[model samples]
Target: MIALAMVDNFPSSPGIYLMKSAEGSILYIGKARNLKKRVRQYVLGSGDSRLHIRFMVQLVESVEYIVTDTEKEALILENTLIKQHHPKYNINLRDDKTYFSLRMDMKEPYPRLTLVRKVPSDGARYFGPYASATSAKEVLKQLYKVFPLRHYPLATCMARKRPCLYYQIKQCSAPCCGKITAAEYATLAEGAALFLEGKNTEIARIYRAKMNLASQDMRYEDAARYRDLLRAIEVTVERQKMVARGGDSDVFGLYRQGDQVQMAVLHVRGGALTGSRTFLFDWEMETEEGLASFLNEYYDMDTPIPPQILTPLPIPEPAALEELLSEKSGRKVTIAVPQRGPKLEMVKLAEKNAQTAAEERLAKESSSATLLSELADKLHLPAPPRRIECYDISNIQGEMAVGSRVVFIEGKADKSLYRRYRIKGVLQSDDFAMMREVLSRRFRAESDEEKPDLIVVDGGLGQLSVLNAVLEELEVEGVEAAGLAKSRTFRDMESPEISKSDERVFRPGRKNAISLRQNSAPLLLLARIRDEAHRFAVTYHKAVRSKVMVTSELEGVPGIAGKRKKALLVHFGSLKAVKEATVEQLSAAPGMTAKAAKALWEHLHEKQQA
Candidate 1:
């Protein structure tokens, strides 16, 4: 405990303390009302008796503390330190994967508004880390209705010989087709930005003013359009009913017991509930500890930090959290524990939402457990399979062959843990060889760890044999592996509709296969597993095939590499034209080179003749 030795004779001061593991990985970072008392707790092992602490204790090779003037100062320092270090025990909000946001590129001559997962520092106004793709799309849809923003890219708009369908439908201003001036479009775009930023009332008022002017000038059609825009904007805001009673803030509440935790967040943008999101943290942790940990962990990640954060209970280091958040946000941050009023109401609402989410989650988990147990019964396994691994190989006649490994822990997909492997040892068109290679790599990795309960292969007995050989080579014992082979085919008849019983299961080391009765519990389970594997494999295979097709086309273009190829495809709908373009047309394409175009033209022409 280098930190302990340093603190043993040190004077009391409020600051941040970071505990590091033996390898110098941060276990946890914290602040205290009294540094001496807090430091002593760790030295003597007297902090909260939570699972996190126990786990932290195992990793803590040393302790460290920074002294500050007051607890508040310590709070601020702690937030900063925690964000920088991201101690393992903290509940990290920043760890959430980035969701798409609606961005309006404000600096462009004609701002291009679109959905983006990450907000770039290109002078664009971004409006979300929206809960879902659908919600973000809904917002964009509503915004377009209120403002004449073009959804299509500038290139597409410019390339169009005349006004497209969107222009006729009144969905776009069609500046690309010279339907609107730069200055006029700019005014409409600014209003759209304001609307997205939760200034709907002001935007509506501006539209109303424009409508009145148009009416007084006797421009009836223009007045009618502005009137409609104002009404649409108001209607959109009205649909978000909860926004009427709150301020711009976030409400957080947690429902946790043991390692199972559900944290729900309701985002109030411009005083309305824009959306709610629920997060499940499955790692073993204490309830209060997890809440605090999640807060620290989440906010500390490199995500956009909001100004106000409202929680049901006060965080362990509220002051520190606020300061740290303020620094990251580049504005003052308020971490409030509301006792009454809208804040309290918001927390209650959030807690209710959390409770509902938790219940729904528990129900799903229970259902999944039931399904797994039934599946085990159907498969005649010793017990319910805790870890079921599904394998799928994807490729078109063996080109760009890849295999995907999807793991289901108690029925639901653990996507973060899902893996993809490029078939390393096998050349093109060798499915069995590719399967063997993928399984060899996979089992070799798992050979040292506990074997999976079941290995599900998405093919016939040949696929099963590949897995069996890999397991035998690795000497991975006791794990049951099976293949869900395709259903029987009748020569003069159509392919038999594969029912649960139709799925033949080839057990490891067994030459004969058994078909479970369609109604049997085990049959249902096997069918589910087989279908899941098939779905995963097919989706992954299609993705690989698509990528290969795209790359093959780009390969013909002389100057095209990875990035430039992506830019070209993103700009154009297809690579066919890119393969068969004139030099002038190809040069006009985004990220296309004269040499690239000529090379592609020659290649396509040569191939066509050959």
Candidate 2:
């Protein structure tokens, strides 16, 4: 450990300090206004009494610091370093995927609503970074019901001689079949954009005005359509709950039990509760520090920022945070801790939700622990396995073979530890060799991944034997291994109801496969894990297979490298579209030239005619 005297010589200015383990892995990162005083607190043994901090301190072998111009800079730098190194004690984000958003390209001949994960500057209108996928999909579903915009791309549907099912369902006006004029479709697209922006009231007002005008002109059919649209908008708006007086805001509530914290964020847009998000993680720092750090990291995600952010506790340098978020959002932003009134009630509501979420999580974990105990008993294991891994192999005639590994911690999937390996040394359809290769590579001495407490092979006796042999050859010890086999179909002539037997688990050295209760919790959990491994393997296998099949139709075209081929597929949506596109249209694919497009056009035509 570094001497306390070393902290004495450290700079007192605002900066971040990184605590490193003996192996040079950053164990924790912290920011402070006065660096020396903060490090001194840890080194002198008196700054905080949190349990994780004590554990972190025990592992600290050295310290390093970088001075910044101000506390705000220190905060930003601390977030950057923590994200890059993923320190052991930091409250990390649970998901790296950006929230879903709706994109509408007004420039298109017919604009269709599409869900996208990232927000890019493409001159099209974008709405929402919806944290809940269901909420986003529901929004689109409701939008399609109200506004009859095209459901598919213009090029894909324009050739249809008759309107599709969506047109019959009233979800599309069928611009492709000329059921709606270009002018009418433009109005629908504009209305859809406004509705996505949470402007239902505005939509109602405009539709009402149009309804009156249509009636006055004696256009009874048009008036009825406008009346129906207005009614739908009113119903939609009335269903939404108004949580604030005005303006967009995000309110945060937190529940903390020791180092574990569950935080809830309520998204209020246009004065109504639009959606919410919850986060569960461990934090070893003071509540204020954790909240501050979370705010920094959370806002840095491509999530949309609102004008105001309400928190349960005051964050350090609210102005700095506001400035950072404002610069990113291109708006004036404010942060506050409400003391009274409706805003305070909103915070309380968030807290109550957070409490409920935390309680539910605790109960679930408790149930999972019990199930694990039962599972251990079923397997004759010494203790309940805390880290379980299941592996499966996938291939079609040994073509583009792949292996998948899925991990479960405390009966929950830990996606970060999941892996998929491409089979390199195996040939032909030898499942045993595939299993052996996968298990050996997974347990190699240099792998940084943690070894599993239990290894489940997704097959019967042969797979179990392969797993055991690999463990023995690698000299790996203390891991439990089992093979899961599917239920066998049983044809009972007298009893048609008894169609299948229970799924069987094969154990090492056991002649008969043990059958757990078919619908029991332990068996269901195992089935879920096994299914995930199979799905992962199948997905990777398809990707490898597609890469092998993607070579056709474009192989002989000049300037059609891998990236260009992918661009063609993406730009045209499919190879069929690419085949049908004219030379000029083909040239429109990113980075494609007139000469290359012509070559591709002639090549496809020559093949098609031949």
Candidate 3:
């Protein structure tokens, strides 16, 4: 346990503190204006009523602290450390998908717009972190219709003898072939950048003047092109409803159900609702502190920080957070909890989104729980198995043998707990031995508490026997085992005598398999788990096979060393892409000389011809 003496010894200054468990893992991280006072409250068991904190305090073996010049600095450090360590007792944002932004370095001679996940500090203009790649691409498509900026890479464009299809379709200016001068292409690139930045009025003005000048010069085609560009910009602006009513700001709303917390952020850029993001976490901290911490972490340098931030809950130390944001953004920033009017309405809308998201999550969890309960009853289990692990083996002719273990928690796949193993001890296509080896290795490494309540193998009686044998040898107790096997032929509904045993579930010591009801929830759940394990194993096996193929193919080419092969793969994304690349593109790749590129190209095509 953390000693009171250590708490007393903490410095009386603004800083962050880390509560570490006996196993040396960080349990919680917090920032305080006075480190000594904050640590004392937890050590003395006073003013810390949070249930999670009480549990964390019992496990804390030591308290570590770092002093900072100000509370703002301490907040920054706290966010960084929390993200780095991901302490158990703290709320951490974990999202499966990251939004993307459109990026272009305007300084480039013929700038090409591209999609990027992060907004870097390099001198380049960034458009957004659009909710999906499709949305970002849609915007790019619209911009291309108007801007006609260069679309090819610098090397490809410079090396090409003729313009590609994009140029023929007037989607690019073809700066590489000198169809458009560098200065003219730069002007077009700037217009595209301006449109992405939501400066539609300015771009429209430029286009209008160009159109009128072209018309006066008797260039009807040029005038028509400029008119179409101006029209596209105006239509896009109207569709997005871009206006400068409330300036740029972000509104945050939070909802909580027990320990579950959901936050919704609505991004209002130039007074238009651009996009929103939702974050879900399990936290036990006070609402104000949680909101403050989330804001500190969410608005890092890479994320565009607006002038105003509206939160439904009043943040603790709002002034300090505002100061920190202002310092980071190089502008005045306001953190407000609006009580009434339009701003308040925005907060309420955000809150509604958070509540809806939470409800959907709870509904899904409830359904999963119901399915798990049904499955448990059908399997004659004492209770619903919270964790079910299913295993499968995949290989072709004993080559690249691999096994997969997929996990399901309350009937929902818990992919994080899934594991894979290469069949190291077994040779040839013996599924029984492969299953035995995999189970032995897995059970030996897992602790008693981490053991699954039920284990499933992706085969019938043979696989079940292997699983039971391994469990018995390991002396593992209180865990049930079963095997699932697919039926050979499709069921004939026309004949009543036809058995609808699409899936057969086998239990140890049971000579006959249990035929699951056709289209039953329990059967479907088992099928999903078994299929996931099979898919994982097959994917790994294929990856191993592909790597071997790539190695063999690369080895056949003389003078191509491992480093050069790696460079080629990294540049082209795969061996298939490398094979498809032209000699010019191959030569342009890093670590490739002209002669080597030609030789590699010839060798790849030669194999294809053979």
Candidate 4:
């Protein structure tokens, strides 16, 4: 039936409504505190300007709604219908339906901790739809550290001769090795569930009690370990402080303009901000109208129902929506318009962040446009260079010295193409020698897989000279090159001050240099490329240095092979922790046995004797 006709038929009672497009696919799903009053707003036309609704009013092929006993029931039904239908105009809960959830399958003999992207129906407890894959893994890492719950697959847990790598890393308690009882593991799993469900206060109390018991039992070290876990939990909660308001309330803020719109959502549970997400959408409609349309569409999503939602605008069906949302949440939901208070402050903060995000995106676009225009003019090229490459060298007393290449497409940095080189044949911190060695090896291996139109070096006259010599020897041509130099210091007090902001550009075979005005487009472009190159180089150097600092028995102690390393790690958990462990403790580790642990301890102790 037509939308207006269906609206005429709607009863003045709680119900779930469905808006559909011409193709018989649902477009929007919503619950109304009063079906007749909510539906009448569409049919009677309260001078609403939403283009989507206007079109629907003109050609709404069909409309449907299900009556519910209460607004809460309608809310539940609306979310379910929205998930099932996935209408075109709905504010999607999970943008990429392929989302991740931390699953704890409590049904198994040895419960498993697995990462699942899709929800399953196998009676597993699921925890999240984390924003990104990396974020999901980060949560998993924190969960493991907090709980040390086993992550072994069902089959592996059933028939395991030894603990796996996770056990060696101390990330798991080795339940497969029978080191921990099933009942104790189950308790940990239950605690994890409560933690995920926003029950931190209860968990904190329990943890404190356990810590006290361990202390009373003369296990001072174990008590300290519990203290560390408590600190981690506090840090996690504090990191999420921005979203939480110490109350069970939802926050929604939007930044929108005619065709572009972004929404920020904060879900506060048990007085803690547990989740926050941002959503962006493009609608071929006006701004205010789009806000109204989006507001209606968003609340219909099938995520957990919050008791209250704070929004910037008064929605079209405010009373009906409040009632419907309240009913769905199984409580009285107050959809308040905060004039001034902490609530208002939160709303303003969200709006400001959203606006800032939008502005940054626009600024980057403008920067890219300017760079493309300037590069085309300066390089004497037919068009702007699409890809630019810059290089820098990093070292500490010539040990673990490395070179890095950073790429910029148009004007923005592209990290995926960043490459690092280990400096060979360069004995010390000689910038010139390092440049020659790094560049020669780089271009020598160029193929269909790698090449750039422009190359930049983070140096001055000497460094560029070395690079030019390498290019000439290699006979590589048609590529433009430049050197960016930092400002030099002056001795004379009366002379104009030399600022770090001052940068000089050097060109090949040129007598004079180019100096971009501190605030000019070219200066900004060059500085951006230089900073990115420095960042890339420093990151690579740190990685190499960290590896050098890490003392591994296999690499350090003689006669320690693959099997021994595995045994040490699996027995002692972590190398650093193992270093601090007593000889008795090390030997007691499962397969290590007393004799082997004693021998290892004596070998390590020989250093003190020397």
Among the numbered candidates, top TM-score falls to 2
lDDT of each: 0.73, 0.86, 0.84, 0.71
lDDT of 4 by residue, 325-421 (tens): 5655466877766778878877787787677777777787787887777865764445666778899999998888999988988777787788899
- Scored by lDDT, the top model is 2
Q: Which runs in model 2 stand beyond 4 Å of their true positions? A: 1-14, 17-28, 32-65, 94-97, 105-110, 120-124, 153-165, 174-183, 215-221, 492-498, 556-563, 580-584, 587-610
- Put down candidate 3 lDDT per residue, 1-610, tens digits, no spaces: 8788778778999999998888889988999988998889887878558787687688889989999999988988898898889988787764445568888998887899998887756888777768788888888887888889876557656656688799889898888789987776777888888877667778888888989998999999879978888877777777886433667788899898867789998888767888888888777767777788778777763577778999997876687789988987778999998998888988999999999988998899899888888888888788888899999989998888999999998788888888889899988889899889989888884555488999989888988999999999999988999899987755577875656446799988789988669789999889989999999999999988899888999886777999999988877766766777899889989999999999999999998999
- Per-residue error (Å), model 1, residue 396: 3.2
TM-scores for candidates 1 onward, in order? 0.82, 0.88, 0.81, 0.49
Segments in model 4 whose C-alpha atoms lie over 4 Å from true places: 1-45, 49-99, 105-112, 117-125, 197-199, 215-228, 231-244, 247-249, 269-275, 282-307, 316-336, 361-610
lDDT of 4: 0.71
Task: Choose 1 or 4, whichever is better by TM-score.
Answer: 1
List the pairs of residues colliding in candidate 4. Answer: 72-327, 72-328, 244-273
Cα lDDT tens digits, model 1, 76-145, are 5666776677666664454467666788777776886888777555666778768778988987776776
lDDT of 2 at 227: 92
What shift in Å separates residue 589 of candidate 2 from its native position after superposition? 4.2
